[model samples]
Structures are given as structure tokens and as C-alpha cells.
Target chain A: MSTVLTQRMIELQGLTKRYGDTLAVDDLTFDITPGCVTGFLGPNGAGKTTTMRMILGLDAPTRGTALVDGKSYRDHRFPLHEIGALLDAKALHGGRRAFDHLLCLAQSNGIGRRRVTTVLEQVGLADVARKRAGTFSLGMGQRLGIAGALLGDPAVLMFDEPVNGLDPEGIVWIRTLLRQLASEGRTVFVSSHLMTEMAMTADRLIVVGRGKLIADATVDEFTSQGEHWIAVQSSNPAALAAILTDAGATVQKVDDSQQVRGLKPIEIGDLALGAGIAIYGLTEQRATLEEVFFGLTGDSVEYHGMLGSQNGQAA
Target chain B: MSIADTAHTTPARTERLAVTNHAVPTQSALRAALVSEWTKLRSVRSTVWALILTSAFTIGLGTLFCWAYLNRRERRGDSIRSLLFDPTARSLNGVVLAQLAVGVLGVLVMSSEYTTGMIRTSLAAVPNRTVFLAAKTIVLGMVSLVVGMVSVFVAFFVGQAVLDRDGLGTSLSATGVLRAVLGAGLYLTLIALFGLALGTIVRRTPGAIAALFGIVLILPLIAQAFPEPWDVRIGRLAPFNAGQAMFSVRYDPDLLTPTQGIFVFLAWIVASYLVAMVMLSRRDA
Candidate 1:
């Protein structure tokens, strides 16, 4: 198990991809180790797909190298056994049957027909194996894509936006499958723009913005990094804000409520009592992962919708 | 069933683990790619339809042309025999239309991958571009060769049966008759490869098909607009005219000899294929 774990690591060293003047994937460096589902978190156009394509050798990086088990993906004679990737679920011939699609991929890697059948059954697509892939729903297409990935029983798996079109049930199925793959000491690297989804599935998070690595930490560490504050409402909000400020806690007034950071709920209550303020509400609010992601990537977002009118209303 | 149910109930996981423990036997990448390419070619409906059209047009049209020739000979008497009588070329005239069907099949072999976005999946599985393209070439070439041979031979035999009614049919033992029949199949196979090369270079169905038509059908007509000797010279060099020269036994001052025709036609295919190989390797999938 330990040997397999070590052999399944994916290493990207100063990997960069530039499309003419635009840098799609900057000089990002990271190692995805086995036994965990590492969520590649990035906003749209943040280069997550570009990075995955480079790792799979589907696209050449402008600089640096992406290695699977310390060798370039192209150098491996049978790369499917080393790593399986589902970069785009729809990147298949629609005219082909589901079974034939997987079979062709399997045969290319010297994988047997039996393994193709096994993966079809595993992905719950055995019933629709004979149907043309064009006839499948988006979720069924996702399943067929996954079955192609699992055809060789590879040690490392990479999925790009795997849950995009999945139903709730399909989403749960993939999350469990990713965890099971990792628990068996395999490397599982999945990309998503949704932080909440990552929070549920990923053990570690590799967050990127504008092709730059923002954070690489465990999920617990990342969540803990978000600001935790106590929301306080009082009759004398100004007095409560002044007292909280004096007590070394940063206080911001939002409407009639004072948001207090660097102080616990118990400490805020004591401060209010000492100040003789009538406290109406005191509730602790930890920033959700979604907010943290937005905060980290706000400046790096490529496109922003017009929200000037809504901003004045909030103010 | 839920993932958990499948995970625990099925022995797939344990079997996979055991399979991974054993060292996989090393197979040649080219061989694996060949098997994969064959599977891809056979699984698609277009391949079947194109081959059927190829055979149908070749045999059906060949018979129709032969019957028409016998009727014309009957009306004109033996006076037309004093001119240029190449019954073999007459019976195999269907290759003119059949080339388009086979060429389209060849174009789809390469261009459809790009149009369908299957190139990414295919390249991911077989990262070696040279091996992947080589395997495709071998499969397409072989399939086209076999289909071309079968179609042309059946067309020859069936058309001869129709032409025999007027005593105008040529036997295989006759001078240049067997070579003409066999050369027709080789000509179609080369055209298929030519279309594949064009498809790979263009990487689009409509663009590649248009380019193929420009070279095979329109080029000869365009050459005719040129003046005198140059017109005949350029016309002989056109891919379709050059291919026609291969199967035409009757000597004509305008058309190239069979040896010159094959060499010139092959040069076109080889040049296009080289450009395709360069683009395929340099460009990102």
C-alpha cells in the first residue's frame, strides 16, 4: 500500500501554458499525493482545465514539466494504467455506442475487454452500454466518461468539473467513488469551481486564481483561516461598537448590528453587560468557504457582471 | 444502485487491486493503436455507409455503362471499333463516381475526430502522435485496399458479363486487361489515402471535402483553360487525371503513362501527409 501510494503521486513543476499574449496557466507548482481527494479549486477561466490538460499531455505547456510517477505522461507506454483523466465528459464521438467508446480506449492501452465490462458495471452504465452516446443524458455521459477513466484500473485519477451536469444522486455517487479510490491508496485530483462541493469531498484544497496558486492546505486549515466573528445587535449600537473597539476587537457597523471579530461570543456578551447596553442578538458567524473563495479570487475574476445599482441599494 | 452498494457488493475493487499487483505485459504501442483504430473504424456507421456506397456505385454504374456501350455499338456498327476500343476502361468508368464515396470515407477517418472532439480522448490514450497516426493510416489503407479490390473486381466481372452480349468484352488473358482491372483498385486505394491526408491537414470535414473535390474533379477542368501543350501537361498532372491514367489501357498523347501517373499521385499523398504529421505533432490537442 505504501509503495503504491508513493508511485501514484502527480508532480507539476513550474508548469505554465501561454496562448499567444494571454497566460492560461501560470508557473504553478504542486504535488498531488495519494490517499486523498485533492480538490483543484479555481474560478472560471482560472486555468484548472489547462493545468489538467498539461498533466495529461493533451496540451503542451509553454514552460516546465508535468510528471506522473516521475515520468512525462507521453513517455509511459501504457499511460492509462498509470493515470486516468476525464478532462471533458463530452470529448467523445457521439456516434459511438457507450460500450465501443470505452472499448476503444481500453484497447489503446492494452487493457482487456473484461476490464471494460467491469468499469461499465461499476459506473452503473451496463444497461445502456449498447446505446449511442448521443442518446444519453448529461449525467449518463458523465458516467460513461468515468467508466472510460476506470477501464485500466489506474492508480491516479483526474476529473475536471466532474459534477457539472450530475443530478444529486450522481453527485453523491462520484463523491463516494472518489473517496473509495483515495482510501485504496490512489491519487484522486478533482477540479471544481464550487467551494461548497469541495468542502464536502476534498480532503485537501489547492486553490488557484488567474492561473496563480492562492492556497494549498488541508480543508480544516483552509476553513479555519476564514474570519470567525460574533454578530451583535444592541439598542445603543454605537456604544456597543465603541466598547468592542476599546476591548481590542475589530467592530464594523452593518445597519443596526455590530460585527465583532477577534472576540468570542462569551467575551462580547460580557463587554455588552459591562457597558450597560441592551443586547438583542449575539450570534457567532464563521465565514463560509464560498465567501472565502470569493474573497481570495475577487480581484482575479476575469468577468464581472454589472452590480452598481444593487450596490447602492445595499449601502 | 447506490455507489456504496456497488462498491461493497461487487468484487471489482478487490479484483482490480489484485490485477494491479501483477506486472502488465508490455505490448507494442503501434499494435495496440492498430487494434484501437480498427475498433474505431468499425464502430462508426459512416464507415459502413461509405463502403456500401463505394461498392454500389462501382458495380451498379459499371454495369449500366457497359450496357449503354453495347447499345451504342449496336447502333453504330463496327465503325467505332476502328477508332479506340478499350472495353476494360469503359466497364470501369464507374470509378469516376466511386472515388468520391471512398474519398469521403477516408476524409471522415481523420476529420471526424476533430469535429467530434474525440481527438483529445484518442490522444490521451495514445500520447505518441506518430504511432497514433501511423496506426490510423495502416487501418484506413488496408480497409480501403480490400474494399476497393472487391468492388472493382466484382464490377469488372459483372460488367463483362453484360458487355459479353455484344462480343465486346475483354478477358483477363487479353493484353493489358488484367493490369487495367487491378490498377483500378490500386487507384481507388491511393485516392482514399489522398483524402485522408487532406483531411488531416485541413482538420475539417467541409474544408477537406472541398479541397478533395478541387484536386480530383475541378483541377482537370481548370487545366483545360490553359493554352495548348500546357493544358495537356497540367491536366496529366492533376490527381484524378493521373489516377485515371493508371487504369486506361488505350494510349493517348494527353494523359501520362501509368508509371508516371502513380509516381505523381503518390507525391501528392506523401507531401500532404508530411504536412499533417508536422501539424499534428506541433499543435495542441
Candidate 2:
């Protein structure tokens, strides 16, 4: 089947949302381009959901604009066909059958019923299509939500925490689905608080904190910003540490292992061999995405509880 | 099951990735939204039960009242010609119960969306808020009008059949009889619309239903507690009293004429609908 590639983009220009005194989304400006998955990363309460809501026109922006393909989402004649969003999995009347739930949304956008059946099959929900939505488990509900998103065959798809209640298999299915959608030249923007999850699924990351843009870069670029070091486990730890230190490398000895900086693993190995100190293991390490996420949003975490404290006491 | 397991089971999954680009006929937004709302209303179980109860209450209670009234007149040995009675009004009295059923159905149509957090999904689908609300109103209005007419007409026919056994029944050809019957159906439809407006404004099922009952039923009783002319003056404007004037053939100085009652009832609905429209548009889903 031939696929037509359209310019599907989500552009937010200084989009601001203020609820009374609290600014939920403060001057968020970014563009989500097509042909790749852009991960919307932020800590909890960092305004990720609020920004998505504004983009979908579920909430009015206090200041600036959120445009989908050069037009506001509300301005689209058939919005579901232009951009589909799964804001909340449970945002449907549970008394209705799963098929009927998707049917109504499809009809609203002038989509055919055949497409509804196709989406149900695509999401692996065809088996339970006749069941009431209220009886569905979280994973089933998520699949049903995805079916609704795919009903109109939209160009741009947005999912707010799409994998919240998925099992391992479901997670793998969604990850594959998201990457496949992006590979097909459709714009796929997914929001998640899990940095590790984004690291695996997103080609690009748009990180935010306290409703402010923090970093906008590729996944490799984001990981490269953190500290890098080489871990050396040697038979002669003391000798290697002294040799590595003398060779202009900062080395810290801990439990017969030397953590070396300012030197490559190959350099340390060559130096250790030259010094006649046998090395058992030479491994390079970089800061994990989880650590990098925390380091960037540390000051912006809205609610911080005392860690490892008992009986409401400060630690 | 793992991703490999799913892939093995569904080898045809690759075809699902292709988005259908077939040409579809462009429909008006209002028509699309109307079709969506109709599907949403019928898919739920509550709508079926509510509509069934509406018809059953109207027909069943009307038959019962007609039978009891005839039995009572026979026991009193009063001639049907000597007594002053509005048989049409008496037969259509079941509308009092039927109104609540229709009102509940109306309230649920709008309020359930808010309660289920479905408003977000709904508004996202039909971003034009005016068109969304208009479609919902049109669908609910049409359904209630049909059901109301069917219920009231069946009640009128059956009640007359029972009363006709005693040679005391009124015909559609009688003076003011057809208007009263038609007015009963119109009154129920108005009540349903009133409930829908309240549901949109309140956005909660229980609260909207309470407000509906308070305005339609309790307010009339409260109005009757006023002193002398103030009592009748305030009472005549209440929805329950206005509805009574619409379907009552008997002339009374304390009540409005059928036309006057319709105008008064319509004023109440218009005021509530305006507030509902404002709240629906301005508030976040």
C-alpha cells in the first residue's frame, strides 16, 4: 500500500496556562516534527498533561498558541482525522460496549464503521469488542483507548502515559507500535515520567520541569551530557591506581577497583600493560538516564517528601 | 504473551499500519454530531429503561385513574351530565409521573459525559462547542418529543376507552379536548429539555436531577404558601402550575390560559438554556 507523507507537526509558541495563582504551563515553546517519536518527558506535576490538553484544545491557553499543522486543533474541520489523542483511557462511558465507544467517536468525525473494526483488530481488542468497557481491565482499556486514537487514521497521534497499566507484553506491543507509527512518517508524540522508558522508545527528547523547557535534544545527546568514566578491576589495584594517576587520569580506588576519569578504557588498558600491572576488567560507564533526569529536574520537583524517614520525621 | 507470540499469532498485522485514505463524503458537522449523540444515547442501558418506564407510567396510570373515577361516580349515583369534569385532563394525569422519567433520561444524556470524564473525549472529537451542544439538544429534543407524543396519545385513547363505557368520555372533536391532549405531550417535552439544560449547567447527575425536581415539583408547593393574591400570582408562574394550565380544560381565575402557560413555560426553558450555553462554552471540560 502506498502511503502519502504529509507535514504533520505540533507547534507550541509560548503556550502558557495559568490556573489562578499557579502557572500550570509557563511559556512552553517547542515543535514536534514528523517521522520520529518525540518523548515528552517531565516529572510528575511538571505540566506534561496540561500541555497536551492545551494542544488538543481541551483547555484554553491563557497566553500563546498551540497549533497542529499550522492550525489550532479546534479549527480543523475533521480534527480526529488530522490528529488523534488518547488523553485518558477511562474517559468513556463504561456502560457502553467497547465497540460502541469507538463507534461514537468514529461517527463524530465522519469516519466509516469499517475503520472502527479495523482499529479494534489493530489494537488486539477485537476479541472483547462486544464487552462493556466497564468490565475491561486496565490493559484492555488502554487498547480500547488506542483503537479510538486510530479510528480516523490520523496523521498525528498523541498519547499521555499510554503504557501506564500495560503488562510486559503490552508494553512491548506499544513500544513496537509507536516506533512503527513513527517509521511510517506519521508524527507520534508520547508523554511519560519514566526517563528510562523514553530512552528506549524515543529518538528525540523534549524534557520539561516546573512547566519550563529544560532540554531539547536527541537521546544520544542527552546521555552524553552526563559524566563518563572508566571502571578498572585489576589484579594489582594499587599499582594500576598509581600508574593511572601518574598518567594524568583522576583515579579513585574502591574495593580493589579503580574508577578512572579523563582517560579512555583503551588508554588505561595500554597503560596498565605498560606498567606490568595485569587488568582483570576494563569497562566504560556513563550516567544512567534516570540519574540525568533527576539531576536536571532536582530543583523543580513540586512535591518532595523526606526520603528514608520514619514516623513523619525529617531525614 | 510476548511480542514474538503476538507477532506469530497475527502475521497479517502489517496491513494494519496503512492509514485508509479513501474518499469519504463530507457531512455537515451538526449532522455528524447528531448521529454520534444518538448512538451514544441508545448504547447505554439506562435510556432503554427510562423510555420504557415513561410509556408504561403514562398508559398504565391513565387506565387506572379512568377506571377508578368511573367507579366512584357510579357509587355516588351521580349522572354523568350533571357533574362538571374535564375527562381529557383526568386521563392525561399520568404525565405527572411520565415527566420525571423523561427528565431523568435527559439529565443522564449530558451529565454522564461529565461524570465519566467523557466530555474531554467528546469535545476533542467535535471541537466546535456550539455544534456539539446543539446536536445533543436536537437529538434529545427529537427523542423526547416522539416518546411524549406516543405515550400521551396512547394514554388518551386507552383512558377514553375506559371512560366511554360509562357514556362520559370526551372525544378529540370536543371543545378544547385535542389541544389539551397535544399540550400534555408538549409539556413533557419541555420538561425533558428543562432537565437537559439543568444537566449541562450543573454537570452532575444527582445535583441536576435534584435541581430539576426542586424547580418542577417543590417550587409550586413553596409558592402556594404566600399570602392571598401573591400566592396565586407567584403560583401561576411555577412550572407545575403552568403545565396544569396547558392540559386543563376547566377555566379557573387563578391559572393562566393554555397559550399564556406555554409562553411562561417557554420563558423558563429559554432562560435556563441560555445559562447552560454560557456555562458549556466558557468552562473547561
Candidate 3:
């Protein structure tokens, strides 16, 4: 019966998961801290879900243990009261009414019926309280899920893509909900594929790429870590890459552009002006979370599309 | 939280699990789980159809079949006249069909959580995943057993009346008549539990149904097609053949014996349940 703060923390030490021969999670070691919304983030197939599964004791970690509130999730006498999670929003039985679906879960956790009514109202499902769950919209289901997560009002709350299917309004609702939970001194961890969404919601980013922990830092720290961040709209990016490289500043190839590493604006302008590559436009760019995520995960993304659907490869 | 996002991400200062020991809710954990499950079951419109259909099919069809059989039997005179008519089989005629209903019912009880992706929500509420699973099985067992038994009883009286019209029936005093009819209720209850066991093991609708049917119907069909000695032996081990043995007035020497049949049936149920429990223990929600 330890508080989440006094507990040993939700630690993953040298965790690895292998399916047949392929490694799904490779030597993952990170602590999801209390009182902050730690974004359990990665592009598709980066093993974010796999890692979460390990923490919850859903997937066996081949190498080490993932302690949730000092003990494994299974070891907790009342795991529900300790940590609440939303792995998938639509995991409810379609035939069940939202009320019934929540009721079953409430009963299992030993919550009262009045609490069920309270949650239904909290999630804004009170209007359709008696309706079957199968008929609910995606946003409605997400709301119901959020209500269930709040039912135990646990200390540690984890959400895997809680906004995946929500509309704009639902999205805003989740953002506020997560922020509120964290502010209330509860640990809130959420995983998402969208960097934009995470940018606005998560306080810390645990970026994973190709089953490896690529970056685990605050947004400022992550962006600042990469020295090579440049925004240039030029007629000659090829010539720019050469000019920036020759000046002793390592130029990293970015999408349809180039990043001048270890160089200030004056240094880049001096090199570009001397090299006869007339830069139509050159702007100093502070690293954004998106740039850092894409830069770190560019090579490992399974698919890339024009829309934010995929990261680097075509389907 | 980060100091830079100044918009949202704030430096994370670690904290306690909200309040304290006295902060725990008044109701216990298990009671809450049961309440949630009850709400889940009654809230669904399909639950009503699923339960009602099983009883009506088993009982109603049982009476109709008995009436038809009696009419045919009256046309011909046969020794052991009363024994020739097995009200047990007639009363339990709907068992096969109702089993499918409850089987789908049971499969959905678990697999639907996976299908709809609700297991995460369920687990989040009650983080002890096995406790969530156990609570579900308990609910399923309670409802299905009650319905299965009730359906069997209704089927018995209705079928008896129809058979009596053709002068081929006797009162409950008839030798094995009462035992057969009542045994059928037990049989349906077991079948529903069998479905629960299969649901836990297979964890999918098609897979669970196919597996249940394969053991109950397909394996028997395949075993019967076998040439000789191996045929009778393998057929007897199959679940349906063994479990259905009690329904017969006189045991078929070619098939599994009465006591052996029950043992075999019980063995299949126990083995499935154990496998399910072991599997449930290892997997994360």
C-alpha cells in the first residue's frame, strides 16, 4: 500500500521482447515518473505498445522487470486502484449499453452504482445513458473509456492513443483531462503517433524508434540536443550541403533540405556567400518536437506518406 | 514537463498517490467488478435476445420434436414401448442449438473485449487482469447455468404432453423418464460451462466456435468415418459423444459407457479450464 511517490517507480530495466526471432522491444530502460504526463511515444511499430504491455505485465519482458508502484502490475493487491489505463478506446462490447459496459468494470473494481452515474455524467454520456454501446460514435466510446479510467481515480493513469478516434472537440476534452489529472498530483502517461498532438499535450517525450529508446528528454532538451537544425528555402540545396560541409560544420541531409550543424547564422552566411550559392532564403530554426522526432526516427519508420499518415516509407 | 514549452510542459515535481490510506473508496474491489459486469450484461440489447432465444429454442423445439416422434411411433407397435420413447433426448433436443447461442454468448463475453479493444479499459479499471477475467467467468457461469437449467425443465413438460397425445408417453413414474429429463438440465448447464471454458481458451468467436464444434460435432463425424477399432475408441473420447451419453435410455455398447462418458466429458472441461487459466495468467490485458 505504498503511494506512487514512495513506491519504487514504474521502472523498465533492460527490458527486451522477442517474437519468434524478431525483437519487438530492445533493451528498453526508462522510468515513467509521477505527476507528469510522460508521452509514451513512437511512430508506428516502434514498440511503444509493446513496452506499455510489459509495464502492465501484459507482455513478458525477456530480460527485466517493470515495477508499477513498487511491484509488478500483477502484484498489486488492487491494480485498478493503483493504476488506470486506456490501451484502446473501442474495447467495449458493441452490444452492451455504455452504462452496462461501465457497470461491469465498476463492479469488478468494487465501485458503487452511484459512481457509475457520476462517471456517465462526467464523460457526457448521461444523455445517452440507457442506449446500447454498439451504436455510440467513436468520440462517445472515447468518452466512455475516459470515464472508466477515472472510475478508480487511480494514481497512475496510462493512455495509448486516447485521441486516435476522437473529433476536434473530443481531442480538446482529452487534452484538458490529462493536464488536469497530472496537475492533481497523479502520474499521467499517454502514447500517440501524432507528434503535433503530443507537442500540445505531453510534458515529457520518450521517443522510440525501431524498438529502441532513441530520445528521452523534455521538448527543449531534445530539440537542443541536435546541433544540426537549419531551415533553408534555396534554389541549390545540393550546393548548400557542400558549402556548409566544407566550412567544418557537418551538414546533415534533411527532407528536401539541409541542416547546417555546429554553425551560427553569420558563419553559415559567410560560407554560403563565399561559395557563390545565392541563398534565396535562410532562417534560424529552433528545433521543434516534430523535427526531432522525424530526425531521430527517419530511417526506422515503416512507411511514409504526404499526409501525416506515414513517416518515411510508402505503403 | 519541460521548462521551455512554457505553454504546457512544466518541470515535473514528483508527488504522492493523491490522498492516503483512508482515501480508498468504501466499497471493496471485487464487489465493484461484479457490478460493472452486471451493467455490461443487462445494458446490451443482444443479451436479451441471446438468453431468450436459447431457452425458447431448447424448450419449444423440444416439444415439437417430441410430438412428431410420438405420431410416428404410434403407427408401429414395439416392445419396451415406454422405453422406446426417450423424452430425455426430446427434452434436450434444443441443447445442441442453444449450445451455439450460449457458445457465441460466452465467446463474446471475452473475445469481444479484445475485438472492440475494451480489455484495456476493463484492465485499467481493475488492473488485476486475472481478477477481471475471473469476474467475467463468474458472471457468465451464473447466468448461463440458470437459463440452461430453466430451458431444460420447460422442454421436458411441454415435450411430454405432445408425446402423450399419441399414446406413446407415461407419467414421470416411467422408469428412467424423470432422471433423463432432469439429467438433460444438468447436461445443458455443463455445455454452457463448457462454452465458458472454450471461450477462455480460444478467446475468439470463430476460433472458439470452430474448436467447440470440432470437439462436439466435427471430431465425432471424422471419428465415425474411420474404418474399425480406432473408430469407436477415438469417437468415445470426443466431448459430445461422452457428454451426450446420459441422454440415452440404454447405453450403446459401441459407444462410450455411461460412467466413462461422464469422466471423459468432465476431463475435457477440466483440461480446457486449466489451459485457459494458465493462458490468462501469462498474458497482459
- For B56-137, candidate 2 gives per-residue lDDT tens digits of 9888998898888887744365666435577898799898888899999889989999999889999999998889888888
Worst 10 residues of 1 chain B by lDDT: B3-12
Q: What is candidate 2's CAPRI-style docking category based on DockQ?
A: acceptable
lDDT of 2 at A217: 91
Quality of candidate 3 docking, DockQ: 0.30
- Model 3, A226-314: lDDT tens digits are 54455665667788777777777777667766666677877777777777777766677776677777888898775554567645443
User: Per-candidate interface C-alpha RMSD?
Assistant: 4.3, 3.8, 8.2
Q: Predict model 2's lDDT versus the native.
A: 0.86
- The 0-to-1 C-alpha lDDT of every candidate, in the order given, reads 0.86, 0.86, 0.72
User: What are the models' TM-scores?
Assistant: 0.92, 0.93, 0.80
Clashing pairs in 1: none
Off by over 4 Å in 2: A1-3, A239-243, A306-315, B1-25, B73-84
For candidate 1, what is the TM-score? 0.92
TM-score of chain B of each: 0.91, 0.90, 0.82
Per-residue C-alpha lDDT of model 3 across residues B110-150, encoded as one tens digit per residue? 77666666666666556665567667767777888788778
Which runs of model 3 end up more than 4 angstroms from their true locations? A1-9, A226-285, A302-315, B1-35, B73-75, B79-83, B124-133, B173-175, B227-236, B250-258, B283-285
